[model samples]
Each structure stands twice: as C-alpha cells, then as structure tokens.
Target: MILLRSGAFFPLIVMSLAFASLVLASLVTGAANVSFEDLLLDPEGSSLLLVSRLPRTLAALLAGASLAVAGVIMQMLVRNRFVEPATTGTGECAALGLLATTLLMQNSSILAKMAVSSVTAFAGSAVFLTLAHRLPPTQPLLVPLAGIIYGGVIGALTNFIAYEFDLLQYISVWMNGEFSGVMQGRYELLWASGVLAVGAYLYADRFTIAGFGKETATGLGLNYKSVVVLGLAIVSLITSFTVLTVGIVPFVGLVVPNIIRRFKGDNVRATLPLVALTGGCLVLASDLIGRLINHPYEIPASTVFGIVGTCVFLWLLYARPQRRV
Candidate 1:
C-alpha cells in the first residue's frame, strides 16, 4: 500500500505531539515579554503575537516541511541521497534572481521578486540535473560533489554582484536563514510552498517509480522526463520561497529526508509526512534553541542547524552502515 500503513501509527502520533509542543513553544518563545496572561489582558501582547510570533513560527514550519519534501523529491529524481537544493544551486540561483530584482527593480513587490527567483531556481535545478545525468552513475558521490561545485560557482557570482553594487547586506540576509525579521503580511508566501509539498505527496507514487531510472519508469508507464521536470519545479519554487522569506536553511532538506528514509525506507508515500513533520520539528526546535541560547539577541537558525546538521551529515557519511546506490 502506498498510503501510510498501520505500523506508521505510533510514530506518526508521537511526531505529531512533538510538532504540536514545538509550535506552542515557538508561539511563546520570543523577546518583548509575551505571556499567556498578556494575551488575555494586554492588547500589545496580543498584537505582538499576531504580528510576529505566529508568522515566524508558521514560516519556520512551512519552510522546513516544504524544503524537506523537496529534498525527498530531488533525491528520488537524481537517485542520490546526499543532494539537496542548497547543494544543487537552487537556493543560490534564487538568491541571484532576488539580487537582480532588487538591483534592477527597486520598487518590485515580494511576489515579483519571488516570481523571478523561482524562474532562476528552476533553470539552475534543470542545469544541475543535466550535469548529474552526464556523470558516471556507478559513482554515487560524484553527483553531490558536482552539485557542490556548481552551487559554489553560482554563489561566488552572486557574492561578486552583490559586492559590486553594495548589496552584500541583502545577500547576507538571504543567505542566512533566520526568523527574526518574519512578521505578519511578510511571511505568508511560504504557504504556497506548503501547498506544493502536498502536490508532491499526491504524486508520490510516480516519483517513487521515477527513482528507479528512466528505462524502468518508462516501462512502468511513467513519463520520466515530465516527472523530473515536475519535481524540479516543486523543488525550485520551495527553494525560492524559503530563500526569499527566511534565507537559506542548509540541510533541512538533506538531513531530514535522509534520516526519515533510513528508518522508513524509500517508499515516498509512506514516508513523506514523517519527513515533513521531522523537518518542521528540526527547524522549530533550532529556532527555539537559537532564541534561548542568546536570550535577547539571536542566532540564525541556519547557523545553528549548520553545526548540528554537519555532525549528522558526517555521521551519515561515515559512522552509519554503507549507503545504498
């Protein structure tokens, strides 16, 4: 069965509870002294919650879930466990597009910027996939290595452009994933990425079939190229939305889906929700930890996750059982 089986019940409930608790913590965990009593008695407190806490929390959850799902799709399409949007130049290209929009059309709305970013991201992802296709399929590590190089080149170009135009600050903001600036009316665009994650789930079976390679997918009556394009579109849009909204959160996509797949296996339909939930939990918890660690000031969620995700990635690379091809 492609749907979640009975065996998934306990873990699903446990993760759901954990996600709920994190949501509660995120809703209350911020500066400016928000409390339950304030919510009932103080208009200012309620306004702060509406304007800041709620939106930031939602942004974290949405970005985490969508990015994680996008990672799963990328892994399946590319047939490699180590690759993700940040590695494949999707986020970098999105940032590039954002920089171009900011420099050229200073009055552009966020939607306009996001539209441009998505286009660039899609092109970048398509290029990465094309390069991956030409690599030696027998060497699984080559795909991600190539992706890292590709992303680095694009990132360098982005940095150079930002430097030339004195927009390094803008680039810095987009490259570091943080929620300190998130507020109502500013972060709602992430909901579309969440919707795209749902779209991924609806196409889960096809993606799973596509993971088996083009010949296999074609024999299975799946349009392999179309599936790849659809997956890339979802990944690009999610990457663009997250980059434009909360900056680039490294490894949420890479680490979460890989962790979930280790235990849940490669069945996309069965594991997608768990991956999404785990990713949301990881980001929300990181955000909460970032807030508490500094008290008044803040650490970027990306910085916090980069430390933790790096360790996890190394463990997955070395300490774990041998990887699948």
Candidate 2:
C-alpha cells in the first residue's frame, strides 16, 4: 500500500484544486443554458444558476463533506473501518423519524422534522452501539455485517410504515440521496451539518483515542462515555440533515474515509480536512456526471455513487487487509 503521511501540503493542494473544478462543473452542467460568460458576467441574473444550480452544488458539497466526516467519526468510535452512519441504522432511523413527523405533524416546519429525525437517528445509533459492544471483539468484520442487518431491519420497518400510510414517496425521498430538487431556500439546513462536521474535527483527538477502546482511553484520562455521546450526536445530526436535504447518499461515508485511511492512515486531526474535501469532490463529481450522462434527463447522485461505492466496497472487502476493531 502507498502510505502518504497526513498533513502533506501537496495532497491538500491537489484535492482542493480538484474540488474547485468539480464545483464549477456542477454549477454549469444542467439542462439550462448556463455558460462561463453567464457565470462570470451576469451571475445573479441567471435564475437557473441562482435558484437551482448553486443550491444543488452547495448541498452536494455540504452533504458529501459532512457524511464523509461522519463516516470517519463512526469508524473511529466503532473501531471498524467498514462501518458508517448509513449501515449502522442511523440513516434508516432518521427516515423513520421523518415518516412519523410527516404522518403526525403533517404541518410541521422543516426544522421540526429535522429535530425529530435527529432524535430518532441518535436513539437508533445508541442501540446499534450497544449491540456492537456485545459482539465478540475478535470478529472485526462482524460489526459491519451486524450493522448492515440492523439497518436493513429498521429500513424495512420504515418502508412498511410508509407504505401503510401512503407515504412511501415521502420516505423514498429520504431513503435515496439526490440533489435535483434543491433550491436556494430549501437547502440551507445542510449548513448545520457542515458546521457539525467541523465541530467533529475539534474533537478529533478524543475520537482517535477513543478508538483504542474504552478502557484504554479512560486509563489515559479521556472521558470515554462523553466522547462517545458527542460522536453519536454529531453523526446523528449530520445524518438527519443530509437525509432530509438531499436524501441518503450511500457509500460516501463508507467509501471515502476508508480510501483515505487506507493510504493516509488514521490520524484524524491531520487527515480530517482531506477526507472532507475528497468527499465533497466525490459527490460533486457524481452529481455532475449524473446530470451530463443523460443530458436534459438527470440521474440521481445517489445512483451514480451507488455503483461506484459498491465496486470500491467489494475491492476493499477482498483485496485489503482487515483489522480487529
């Protein structure tokens, strides 16, 4: 494996430049006739750019970065490289929360829905962690397999409830991640997820320590439980916000961080920024490809990433070395 040490200046520069290029591509690649001239000269006059393109691009970037960070946080806390928020019932529980809010408080505001989703997501994550603790530590791969099954059950429940109430369409919006509907006013809530991702960086050292196991971290004077709670909160809130805004973009959290950790190592403080940028680049590039692949018709970013993520996941599962969590 090629190990690139974290905090390297060159990698950051390259990733930043690639991210910028993807953002520009996302801004201009749509059904509307937006040009570099229109972007540079009449930036505000183009309703498509102002109303749709910019918002969608921002949403993609925010969701990607936040989810990738959340994934890193999850892997750190769970000590399982394969685990992520989506696999561990967090996203499914968020969908359940959204479904409940839609059914009960049909007139509730978006913030209200997000609050409910965050609570449910947190509760679900806590449950998963409890189950994880019960699993034999020697079987490292079992954690992710259990998480996938746990998430599947919650997702099945959410789907059944949504189908019963004729809200499958509503639930599907959160189940699948996409950015086509994002407009200026509709996507600002994702900024909170971006903030929370940054917040996670502040506690990166604690998380890295926590990954060494509760006893070790506690022996070293870390507040193990407090750090776990904080990590769960960050993961849940980020998941809720992204799910509500752009749907659940699967494999972002699963694929991006593992790829980073594989080469960059797990120094959260040094590698966190690169993980966030690479994630944003992945989602924005996926979004742009989805838009251009079908021309006037668009594929969801989730679909594009699903194919890519699955391939990478298989490669990781078979080709890479596994570590005990």
Against the true structure, candidate 1 has what lDDT?
A: 0.92
Give one clash count per candidate, in the order shown: 0, 0
| Reference-based TM-score, model 2 | 0.95
Question: Residue by residue across 1-325, what tens digits does model 1's lDDT show?
Answer: 4335656577788898999899888887887767867855788888887888989999999999999999999999889999999888999999999999999999999889999999999999999998998999899999999999999999999999999999999999999999999999889889999999999999999999999999999999999989999999999999999999899999988999988888778999999999999998899899989999989889999999999999999988986664666
Query: Model 1 has how many clashing residue pairs?
Result: 0
Residue 160, candidate 2: alpha-carbon lDDT: 93
Clashing pairs in model 2, backbone N/Cα/C closer than 3 A: none
Kindly list the per-residue Cα lDDT of model 2 for residues 248-280, writing each as its tens digit: 999999999988887778899988999999999
